[model samples]
Target: MNFVHFATDIAHVSGFSALGLFIGLLLVFGIGRYIGVRWLLATESEHTSAGLLDGAIFGLLGLLIAFTFSGAISRFDDRKEMVITEANAIGTAYLRLDLLAVETQPALRALFRQYLDARLEIYQKLPDLKATEVALVRANALQGEIWSAAVKACEVTGSVPTTNLLLTALNEMFDIATQRTVVALEMHPPTIIYVMLFSLALISAGLAGYTTAGIAKHSLTHMVVFAAIIAITVYVILDIEYPRLGLIRVNSVDRVLVELRKSME
Candidate 1:
């Protein structure tokens, strides 16, 4: 089973979850308003002393949203930066192929081209995670072939400086590939964080509704705007976190690799 598929599925689920949360927030808000109205009638008091609790809950919700939103943006930037880094690394390593014997350059250069294609294909196949996984595996295999070919070419050269420089570039290139894979697959915050976020959002909505109960009538506009903003915020966060599978994406960054591949030709 491909873990990329799992991640993509999770992103899809999160998107749907955000939509559900919008409706749930509206429902919970109405229910809380009903309860608050009954409480107002029973107590016959215009004000309640639980202001501190409301502040705390809303404060916590704000904190969670801020942190998650920030983290998602940071991750989104990292993914874009990774694409550029990988492109540079591959280009550097490809250029270093000149250090090898004239006869050895063609095969290694061809491998580099194939490797870059595989890398690009991995993301190009996005949302179709099975295809992406296949591309990823192909890229990994090319990494090994490139390394082994480079090692053999270095041995053929029998020059310490050439071997060191060429092999170092190859190593960095492969390392960046591994790093990109890890970032794409494993860098998300724990699932519990998102669960807590959703829970807090709903709780905050309920509290907001309860507070608004003091008013004689419900403001449909205010309620809708509040729920929409929260839902959109959550969706954007998730979209940024899983850029490949969402409206917010790092696909533009792939152009770096595409340019590098064009240079190879």
Candidate 2:
């Protein structure tokens, strides 16, 4: 995988909070050190304009943080809902299996069990592309099996209420699975947005350090606290954005799917 993909995988596994904090502090401290060195070598000028620019940039950062944070929260909620919806769809389809003829019921139910097992396995292998792919292939094959069985059963018996119901439920089950998969893929914000946010943060920190160079002594406490706040905010944003990989994960909501599987048993 490429760098972006590898980094994303890492973020999903352990999240970016600690890393973000480290980078934030490093930028603040490094920039402060640079400014202190430069201040000693060069004559100082009024920092009024610098202060204005710094404030503007910081304002932009705040706005961007709010925008991304809200988006992350919205997507997180959407994925949670999708999990519940998918579980319901599967449950409905499983129950509809009762509508099938006696001989067809057993085979179809077995396929349903396999399909749910595969679905559960998919979540269990998150951030593992190869394992997820294997699970996806298994799930798709089982879906085909279930679809074929349902169709064959419908063919054996002419148009009837049970046949129609089973086919409809099966289609819904498959449709919701596809929808949920798409939502999962879309949970991330564009990577460029993250890059822009990080760049802005670094620049703002540098400007803050430069503006403080006029002071007799720098306030390490203020700089550290400021950087820590920004880092924590970024961490929270990332946590929400990458729900599967972050501290604030959607894994808890997956209990719906797990319980549905138990009901199958």
Candidate 3:
């Protein structure tokens, strides 16, 4: 899971019963202490070596998280850019359709409107995969209507040039939509990797807490800062990976749909 999904999981964890919280905290401290003790004992370093070892553990955790999260964040930005590109592509195609004969406008616009609605419906169904599949089938069927209508315009007018433009625009629109879907699916966090990261993060957190007790003059602020950073970072990663929810969302294609609606006027 990306940062968003991970945050949801943590948010879910926060709601656990008191007993669960107690056990969780206990495990953190206990497991952490065990690991810290073994690690520190096995070392034959100087007296001030504890802090260094502890810092090393934290540093390693930071590195692992940064690497994974950086990739996720890059993908998140790419998804956003693709959305804008798709909107532009569709808009361009819609405008080009205007150059066709006046007789063709009404049917083409109507088909465009239906296509936009069907497209929006596809995303709205995304919360449920089964529903999304159903929506895609319907959307694809609508696209067929669009295809038939576009083709019929050229055949009726017997203008090869007009047909060529309509076909070009429709083809690009379809390509853009497919690209958007592929990006969304691919950008999601891999479940297996998420599990591994979480397991490691837990161990890292436990070790962090355990080693904390072994040190003196350890600022409460430092601990708070680290925890906050880790939690927030995890949450953001989830957001990027699961763009369907929270602050970063795969927005509905409302803008294009609204524009298409206006053409009816």
Candidate No. with top TM-score: 1
lDDT of 1 by residue, 150-200 (tens): 899989988899999998998899889888876566898998999999999
Error in Å for residue 27 of model 1: 1.2
| Candidate 1 runs further than 4 Å off | 41-48
Clashes of each: 0, 1, 9
What is candidate 2's lDDT per residue for 42-146, written digit by digit as tens?
A: 423445555576789989988988888889888878888989888888989888877666777788888888999898777677667677667778998999999
Q: Which ten-residue region of model 2 has the weakest summed lDDT?
A: 40-49
Which portions of model 3 miss their true places by more than 4 Å? 1-26, 34-53, 124-134, 189-192, 215-229, 250-257
Count backbone overlaps in model 1. 0
- By TM-score rank, best first, the candidates go 1, 2, 3
Colliding residue pairs in candidate 3: 2-237, 2-238, 3-237, 3-238, 3-239, 4-237, 4-238, 4-239, 5-238
Which prediction has the highest lDDT against the true structure? 1
Each model's C-alpha lDDT? 0.87, 0.75, 0.64
To one decimal, what is the Cα RMSD in angstroms of model 2 from the true structure? 3.6
Cα RMSD for candidates in order: 1.8, 3.6, 5.3
Tens-digit lDDT track for model 3 on 78-144? Answer: 7667666766766766776676777987888876777766666666654555566666677678778
